[model samples]
Target chain A: MNHFMTSIFLILTLQFTGVSSSLALADDSIFVIAGKNSSLPQITATDLKLIYLGQKSSLAGKPILIGQNESIQESFYATFTDKDMTAINQLWGIVIFTGKTDPPKNLKSDSEVIKFVNDDENAIGYVSKQPEGDSARVLAIQKSTTTTSK
Target chain B: MDLWKNIVFSCRLFIFCLSLATALATSVASELQINGFGTVGAAASDDQSGYAYDIRNKINYYHDTKFGLNFSSRLGQKWSWASQLLVKRWVDDTFDDNKVKLDWALVSYHPWSDLSFRVGKQKLPLWLFSDYAEVGFLYPWVRPIQEVYGITPLNTITGASLNYIKQLGTVNFELNAVAGDSKVVEDRNGGIVLLANVKRAQLLTFSLIHENFLLKANLGKSDAVDVTQRTGSSSYVFPQLKYTFASLGAKVDYQTHFVWTEIVTTHVEHLSNMNGLYLSYGKKFGIFSPHITYARYWSHNYKSVRADTTTSTATTTVRVLSYVPERKNKQQSLILGLVTKITDRSNFKLEWQYIDADGYSRDTTERSTTTGGVTTTVTSHGNTKERGFFDAHPRGEVNLFSATINFIF
Candidate 1:
């Protein structure tokens, strides 16, 4: 009886299928990194939230953006920013449907993010581990990240 | 009337121009992005009188179902173009015959980080979520509060808008101005539909957006030209309409909880005036979120005109009898819902609503008397039929159950 109930529960709950990326795994620590040649501002947690939410693309310098939905560290990065990948996607859905801006580019791996940031002086992305070899510079979250941005 | 007759021609001309412009734009563009959203919903209502919210005694799986596709491309750092195609079933329209409506097809130019100019087809920016109301996954409930959101039919327009974004301390403020014309299609029967042409439609919206908070104000005005549709021999019972509306909205969003509310007042030229408000609250528990809302809509300022002529002459005296039809549409409801986030792009939601409404039916009658060498007629309006907001005749109240699977990619 217990096994039958478990099977029924699984059938009911796991039947919903979505286009999920295999790269979505929550990591230990996430860092917001940009190109070393970029003149990024002291972005608060709120400002970073706005960037991920597709509200603000730039601050002080050129525009900032997030990695694509299929990014390997997207879940960890969103969690570090006090958000979930679903929440971020919902917000971007609103902005994109309004024709305000396009969705993020497909950066399937952290190494791709680091490479893109290294090439573009205006680009920004998040990674699970701290980048090395002066490839990218991690900006300081000016406000305390312990508390949620909102 | 002429504009209504020439709607097909106008739409063709606009489509040609837009296609030409897109061709010119894509000639220099190299990247194209496609995005879309869809919802499959089923709803049921227990109402003995008639249908309400498109739900009758049986389960309805098509009323709330919809699909949308948006294609966008960037021409350069300063120019971009976007267009959306939508297919959805509506009340009075059968399944497998949903109309493919062009929600928006516009080109945007951004010369600065804070300024943007767009021209073409755009959604009227009336309320906070009115710009993207079709995306069911973005809202807390199975659908937006129908009491307030269903007050107008001018959903999309073909015109131009200017947006100016500014930053003030900790808040991001945006001022949006829209000017255009719209043709709203109103479905009356399976074959007969009313087409209303809105002229000189203008709207202004001011929004202050924060990471955890939002405040918005909107003002809009429009005039409708009479255009009746005829297929075979059926005609619509639509009136020539005009309206002006003003609204205010606020939202407090957090990772664990959210509170949202909006209030609006609308004054119509020949129809009834109305006021509506809805307050919603929701809290998250891991993958499950439970939400609740209280909404109320009422119509007042019922207009009555009195004209008296000579009813008695010579040797006979006549008594004047008047009857005026009462105009009303009112509703109040409590909605409870639950949402489960199944994945980053999909969600499952279930909702139950308890609604109380009145004033949707009326009867027209006239009293006339002939005296001496003249004839007199007295025209009046008022009847005693209590029809609810979503039903032809309900059993005083109603209970509705709904479920949907929403997704975007």
Candidate 2:
């Protein structure tokens, strides 16, 4: 009886550890990044929402160029905009089809996004992890009711 | 044959211009973007005498099928150019002649981050979805509720506009003002086609947007020439007419639930007064979303006068004849729809609508006349007999079912 109790405790401990680690892995954090020379140091959640919705054209009196990573767009939009990828695309269809504004430039990977942002002084982008580029800086996002960020 | 020749010529010219623009943009601009959206849809109605516009009992694709292409070029920092071309088959018989048309062509200048100016042809921003009505992938319904959208006869105008956008904390405010002119054509059962030339059109819109809520108001005015009497080789030109409209709209989205509402009133001088209302609610669950909408349209105090002229060898007389006064009509519809996202770029939608219309009559009139050397003589005339709204379905109720596949890239 003592051996059986010890084995049951060990199994429960392993199961809890495994579940927690998987949750941590699945909870990938998204970061908003801008060019090193950009005038915007940080962005509020409302402003970010407006920019993505094509309701605002700039931040801090500087023209904004938006870049997107195709790989993480689904998760990033869901987290930041509270919208799925399909919803985001539909919104873009309205904006673009109306000739109101152009959509963001789509890049294949985080490296491409980092490169695009670094080349354009007014550029902004999102990524799952911090990019390995000195020319791009991660802009701290202000906490707000509409956005969730890490 | 002449129309076909003209269509071919127009197509060739458009192709040549497109190629030229592409070459110039590739050589000068750093980037050019081309995008397109299309809908392949079919609809059927249960009314034998037809229902809602020109739809009949047969499954029809021409009434709602449409495709559009957009081209945008970024010119330097302060300037950009955009153009859109749309091909649609509408219910009107005259639209069959011009299936392909230019939707918008505008050159915009952004001198400041919050302000911009655009000049050229543009969509008349009257309602919430007016700008992108043909893009089926954007909206929640299979189509915009017809009762509200059908009231606006003009959708595009040659115009110049100024737009201002400002963000304050959690609220965003936008103002748009436009001045333009347009020509609208309407076909009345292939017997009479009215051409309206509108001038001095002006519109103003204000919107306040929160994170998930939006409030909008619009006011517009225009002067138009009623050219209906000139359709049958008549040289007489009617006087200029004036019209004004005001509308309010609101929308809310919380979690997976959404609601939208709009109300509008229009006054056409010496013709009629019109009002419309639309309400919609929807909820999203994963890749599937279902929505329901109710729309109503009412016309009050419709008035028109008909004159008759008779000529003989001895006398030519013109008499003031019958008058239609204080006529009223109303149409209401309820729609239930389901939309499913098949992929990132494709969507499939199905909708069922029940429509009830009242205060309308169907009539047929016949006139026989004889002409001699220099005088025309009136021989006989038959009066029009009023009948019910639907000959086959006497209740004036129609059921419409539609399915569409929409895609964007």
Candidate 3:
């Protein structure tokens, strides 16, 4: 009877832990972030697309610089722009060839992207985790119909 | 002397700017970036005489291959400057001289995301690919069709442009207005030189981009002047020739297939009216993409009249009017090509083109006549001989094959 009771307890503990971990994983969402002092409080998915595609150069009244984390670039673009890394790079080739705009600066990790945004008031970046600091603020993104969570 | 001086000055200025940029890059490193693109291509045609292809081609790399370098610098938060330098051998020249040219040097200001302004020498966006026509890696074909792109004599303009962009839900709209001037020099028949001057050129474009579709419309007008001087003390001037043009274009991309089409009409005062249409379709399969294109060029008859007055011995004046006719021509071409991406930044392309042209040229006939025991010869314009593409050589079909390797860095 004691052995059966211990087995039940182990099974219950495993089930509870699995559910908690899955919920925790689901809560870690990616976000588009900017400097705390930036005038831009929120951005739409269309605006983000234009900014990253080199169609628009600024946000609000300030010229904007774009930084991307290499680790999450594939997922970020796939989820937000409805494109893969190869497609994004091809689009940038056209943009750069036109002599109208330059490609974004690439960062090695999400922390680097956050650091870049924090250093430049006109800079914006994307990361997987919600940044915890006073230098950066997360902007509300109005999702579009095409955007899909990966 | 003035032209040479200007050229030398431009060269010196370019060198100085390049040195300064390099210095700044070494010192700061983060504010400046340099990139480049190049094409090493060779093309051949079945016709031994010549063929008017993109740029120029005669089975040689000197005429078809080109290289370019781009420099971009960020100045503060709202201002930036960029420049591009291109080097290529021209079709009209036997040797590579005057090959180094400045493609664009512009300063851009963006005060808001919706509005922007630019000034300086910039690309005249007359068509969809006009801004990046030289970047072969960005396009599927080895090169754009010459029959369509060759119609415009000017590619870049010196002036300013204003652009406004707005997004509404799933659709995006862009409106662009440009005002500029252009000067071009042409070599006629490889000998005579002609100068074309364009003034007060204005262009307006509107484009709407949706999920997988794009629609664009353009309208432009300009005042053109052409000057031709002969070896003797004779010169001709065609002044204040008005030119107006309009075009409509649409592009669709769905899954692995893409289609692009456009139609253009140009009217030139005291000259022939030209109409052009082009359609292209392509599908991607893994690393390879195959495409086909059809293009047509048509022109209407050109007519001009001149009046001459003569005085007789009795003080009577008579006026005689003479009319000149420039025959019209129609040309069509079919192009098949394949592109394979070697990597993310490089590609290889092979293309084949077949062209058909029909026109008539004036041929002279001579006759001998005897009047009052004297022999005289008379010559008149008679018989029309069939001409080839653009009234070129043997009036028949033309085949061209090209292979190119393009890359961007």
Candidate 4:
């Protein structure tokens, strides 16, 4: 019964406390990039999350999402999507087991992500730094006001 | 043979999936993707009471540990196939009858980007986390609550499912319907406790999601049979029974916080009625996620009836209806757990559970016979005790500890 009471107190305390995303993002601005020839509109954070999570097939056009398997993913996800690399992989595990969708195409580094996006007109990905010249088009992100990076 | 027909059905489905996988063979391995998940765990309890059948002072690692491999392939532009092969290591004869099994074997046709149809053996979409309930790495706990998930053994359904999804901005709406037939038996400590057979089962579910919040509602019905009370000299079988259930589930995931809850009510014609619910809250701090869950389950049987034809005359018929109270497994439990992320693909979990039982029955009423043209009605009052899950109601309480490591490849 002591445990029960302690648990109840904790539940009540947590229930009343409203928690928001605390991951700061001012230091780095990860760009949502695609091929220069692509015609994609500015996307919302939700749509970007959906596409990268393999839950959505496309946005305006048939776009193939490319994932990054490097350290940049840690900050890219934390800044844009409130989740970390571990949480992202956990979500993919369940989605794969349920036969919902296949894993996204993952590139090894920022250069690989950039090269792939520049090669395929329908390929979209995220990179730590902006692409050089006119090689790729940056998908302007419309972040929700409440979830905007601090 | 009818009692074991479900086993045969599962075997047939397994072979069907294998044959289809072989037929869709391709030299290029990348086209057919492969993914696998595994969990190794052990549990023990300090209680020496025989009531705690499997978890009494002994570290048990066989039942909770399991591994499975999933295969998925895109046949054409609109067709796809998926199959899962589950393997378990059993150190005893309890599960020797079922060493290896297939978890899912289905072919899907996406007529539209938002609509799809699948037919094969698939897991029942019963709860909030039913899809990934078995994969411990997906959840923060060592196991799902027994009060809600342990009511029956009917997890797999061999039939067809249709899903319709509509994405409106960030919010998504989905309506799913499934129809099938299945059979299974409950085995506890190598003893057959009861059996469930579904002749015709149907489920309709609707869900809505926005951001990290999800709400789901479900309704299901089955024309089935109930076989119980086999521990004594005799067993009772309620055939041609109608079982029905309705459930509501909700979950909120924002940042590192998660809250999940679900309520369900079920009824079996001429048998019993049951209600169960659970609420869980968890939060992640860095690589560790600590969580707590509270759950409860209760049941009550329908009033019984008896016919006294021996004393009936030709002019009138005598019928007696008795409202007897039957006690079943009424239980409440609290679970405290912590999940530590070892790496991106592995997790180590620990949990402490406290279970308190509250329902038991022992009849001591004596009824008068019709020896001298006398008729008596049954009584509801009985000698009551506290027992649930635990066979012996030692103190009507138990404390269990568990640890596990889950990984995906």
Best by lDDT: 2
TM-score of chain A of each: 0.70, 0.72, 0.70, 0.67
lDDT tens readout by residue for model 3, B295-328: 9887764555322333333433333333333556
Error of 2 at B356 (Å): 1.1
Candidate 1 stretches with Cα past 4 Å from truth are A7-46, A61-66, A111-121, A127-150, B1-30, B48-53, B90-96, B188-194, B223-241, B300-325, B360-373, B380-386
Task: Report the lDDT tens digits of candidate 2 across residue range B240-317.
Answer: 778888889998877899898999888877766888999999998866789999998887644454334444444333
lDDT of 1 by residue, A36-137 (tens): 887876567767766666667777845444554254434543454566667777777887888876566556677888876776666777765678878889
Q: Pick by DockQ: which candidate is best?
A: 1
The fraction of correct interface contacts reproduced by each prediction comes to: 0.41, 0.65, 0.43, 0.39
By the lDDT metric, which is better: model 1 or model 3? 1
Q: Which window of ten consecutive residues has the lowest lDDT sum in model 1 chain B?
A: B301-310
Clashing pairs in 1: B52-B390, B323-B380, B323-B381, B324-B380, B324-B381, B324-B382, B325-B381, B325-B382
In the order shown, the candidates' DockQ scores are: 0.39, 0.34, 0.21, 0.22
User: TM-scores of all models?
Assistant: 0.79, 0.80, 0.78, 0.75
Q: lDDT by residue for model 4 over A16-88, one digit each (tens)?
A: 3312335443465677888788776667777877776545665674434455536456666666566666677
* Model 3, span A1-150: residue lDDT tens: 999999998876654333322221232456899987766658877778777766665677556789887766656676677764445766777666665554687677778888878778878998777778765788743222332222
Model 1 lDDT tens row, B1-409? 4355246434544564465467547744445666778888998888754333457667777667777777787676678899887766644333234556677999998777788899999988788788888889888878778778867656788999999888776688999999889877755433445567777788999999876788999998876645455444644333456768899999888869989899988876654587888999999887788999999988753443222234555666565532223567788899999999887788999999998887653534455666665666666545555554564656767888999999998
DockQ of predicted candidate 3: 0.21
Model 1 chain A weakest 10-residue run by lDDT:
A141-150
lDDT of 2 at B100: 62
Error of 1 at B141 (Å): 1.4
Q: Model 1, residue A47: displacement in angstroms? A: 4.0
